[model samples]
Target: MNVILRRLGMALLILFLAGPAYAQIDTAAREAYLVDATTGTVLLDKDGERAMPPASMSKIMTVYAVLDRIRQGRLSLEYTLPVSERAWRMGGSKMFVEIGDDIRVEDLLRGVIVQSGNDACVVLAEGLSGSEEAFANELNRLADDIGLRDSAFRNATGWPAEGHVMSARDLAHLAHRLITDFPDHYHYYSELEFTWNDIRQSNRNPLLYRNVGADGLKTGHTEEAGYGLTASAVQNDRRLILVVTGLESQRQRAEEAERLMRWGFREFENFELFEAGAMIEEADVWLGASSTVPLVAQNDVLVTMRHAAREEMTAKVVYDGPIAAPLQAGQQIATLRIEGPGIAGHEVPLVAGVDVPPAGYFQRIYQKARYLLLERQ
Candidate 1:
């Protein structure tokens, strides 16, 4: 199949309003990243790719690794692990477990996700790999294997270590994976609070109590890393992932996160252009039993654009004129290109909607004659 591209029109350029531009957001956080999950659009990015101290936010990977082990049957939530002297002695938010006591994996998960307990992280690290050093190695290995190219791990607790680091974008990617990969266990992050040994601690995540669609995520802070958070939310069926770091204080971190989430939800809208297998258009068939065959999208096409734009989208459907038969159903024979101002363009595969066999000799002759006549007209 051959395909051609043509510029639809100039009207679509006006999709982004020209007056003073869309409202700009200024953040007090030293680094930030926001993405429209539905459309994969980077709505806001500030040093998103720069590797920096991720603080407790790095625990997301620890949680991820443990959850993966659970999924692989290497570990179970009910399994109990001995708290090492090292874990018990670790400072910063504590789950308050005795050194000799055995703690359930599920409770430790809560300690990390809800309380940001450094001790809990240590317990998990030691329990999973027999030592934090080995677990850190696994962290680096898993990070490289999973496409987190810029992140490096020194330890599981995000305690002040020499080379512990991750990027804002990397954290957002990890958050996406956690949500999509472990739906069964993701509820732990959203839990408002977790209690153990008669002591209860509320989740540190700032978005949970807000009316906004914020659900689950992790928060981090260290003297060196400042404050950081990797947050995700679903509003009106649209999900967004945001990562922010290097804030002066916890208040700034919480405020900045909420503001960014609000802006992402209010400023953009998701448009579903075509559902999977939905006919996009029709293309003429050359010397085929049928005159034409439908061109359908292979998957749902969703685009994100500014909420108040006035211009209609421009779409170009390109394919070889009169595709030659015998065509097979679901064969990719065309391309659907869509563009809009202030939104990234999309090129999606277009498939043949149905089978089209080659025409008989007489039918081929007649089709050729008809084409010639139409050309003359």
Candidate 2:
């Protein structure tokens, strides 16, 4: 009877401890995910890993590849390329690149982004790779290099193709990588409007104006692909990447993206686990010159969670203790894991805060004796 009572009491205590940690995540999209750009931690996801048509969001890779070429000095934004008839005939969303007209690479980028111009994409692809097919091969190669396993590119313009597809998680990964890896050229993704041949068009990504902190990204729509968006925003020095795919309408895509962004920014707080090289705690030593050695973090540790449950968080550090001396600085020594309500726990590797050289011969013998004695403690 006493054992039963104790078990029931522990169950009640666990529920009481966890009750306040739950927050309703109101994200509405067929395929969606949110990730911390700095930490690469997935905060929310629904069918995010499943492959789906990215529609025009595929252009994100197209632009990324082009920017890479420009950075390598193989291409220049000021370079001019003649518009071909094939580029002019591109079916959907055009910057009116007419045959025989020459346009600068810089202006073509604005056209592709602001107007969702298939024509502009073709011109850029042909200009950079000498052909659209070659440019797409480059896109796929780069995607593999960047860890986008489920993404494949068939064309530069993101026009519907049989095998051209990407998962929501992969899209977010690509967007986050672009911003973090190439900040110098990332500003171009935020351009709101562009003019070509005296006609102006606005970018389709609605979150740029509707959501605070929303900076830049891309949007796409096709009868078969539906409406999709890959958006990102920064708040309190933390940047978040969001991907939403296959919405029924443009209005729904905008509304849902804003809602998801708001839910993430307003509800969650990011916690720093440890500062880079900051000592976590000291490990006990036996017969060494120093009685204790410091355990540190190799990198900044961070996690995101619901703001109200911050007090409930707990951290546990695990490592092989009484480490043999001659430990080098920056060597991985342990792991720090954090757990709290409503958040899945995450681990960050801990490292030796400083070098610890072995003791002299006499000291080594003494340490062995100490270990034998301490085993009883």
Candidate 3:
């Protein structure tokens, strides 16, 4: 079958008067990070990997571990766990549970996520692992398993303890996993308030109250760590994860998070080049039953480009042509090179769409002679 190659835009005709410009705006936070969640592109990073106290933001990891256990069928949300004296006496934030109270796992989750209750975190931890120390170990183990190397947990409550640290990048990554891996439970973070023992505490996450499409995540604060927030927002089907830490005040953390998210969505956009299994071009086949085979993309080709410069987008299908048969389906035979304004060129794999067996000897001889005559002419 014949396939027509899609023509790329004439990008050379357009001149980019300036170099690629990302947001150069200053933020009040000591460390910050932003990412395009859908494309997995890091749009901004300012000391994002410098490990420091994450405050209560680390509680997201504890939530992740609990959700993972539930997913594995080892625990259930309805199961009740006992509150220890350690949980009751904890300071910072409190869900107001008394010692010996049996709290459902789901309510505890709400307390930890929505209320940012240090006491609730301890309760869940001790109940899950018999002691807070064992739970901290489990937290570290889970972090390692999930590739969060830059983070460590000394306790599940993020209660200003020594050696409890997480970088802004790591926090953003953890937020991504929580949203992507446990969609069912992630809604707990977006709950406006949770009440236990007649004490109603609102979610500390500042983005929830803003006009932006911000949703679930966490906020953290301590005298040592300042204020920090790990936030996510979805606009126009594109989601972004942002982390801002060490701001002077809760107001600054909220403003910085919102500003960065706005910049990310305004400056960059995802451009769809081709869908998966779409024929991008055709590749010539030598000594094959068919003279040509279709080249198709293995997955969707989405490129992040500057919003002001998407018209400069262009793409080309490149391959060493006239491949010798027999060719198998799904064999990688070409590369789809794409380039656009304010972005580096990227290559995606293109694979053979069908199998092709070698032609009979006489047929090959005739085709070769025909090729030689054509070349001479």
| Global lDDT scores for all candidate models | 0.84, 0.79, 0.83
Which pairs of residues have clashing backbones in candidate 1? none
* TM-score of every prediction relative to native: 0.87, 0.89, 0.86
lDDT of 2 by residue, 1-377 (tens): 01111120111011111226554465657788988787666767888889888988998888888778888898888989999889989998889988998888888887876788899999999878889999999999999999998898899988888998999999999998888777987777788888888888888999988846888799988877789999999988988899988889999999999988888888776767668878766665544566567778777777666666645666666655566667777877666666666556667777777777778888888878877886777
What would you estimate as the lDDT of candidate 1? Answer: 0.84
lDDT of 2: 0.79
Which lDDT tens digits does candidate 3 get at residues 225-334?
Answer: 99889999989999999998888887778887888888888888887767989876778888999988888888887777566663445566777767789999999988
Q: Candidate 1: which stretches are off by over 4 Å? A: 1-24, 284-287, 320-322, 364-377
Question: Total clashes, candidate 2?
Answer: 0
Model 2 residue 91 distance off true place after TM-score fit, in angstroms? 1.4
Candidate 3 overall lDDT versus native: 0.83
| TM-score comparison, 1 vs 2, better candidate | 2
lDDT, residue 165, candidate 2: 90
The per-residue C-alpha lDDT of model 2 at residue 112 equals 79
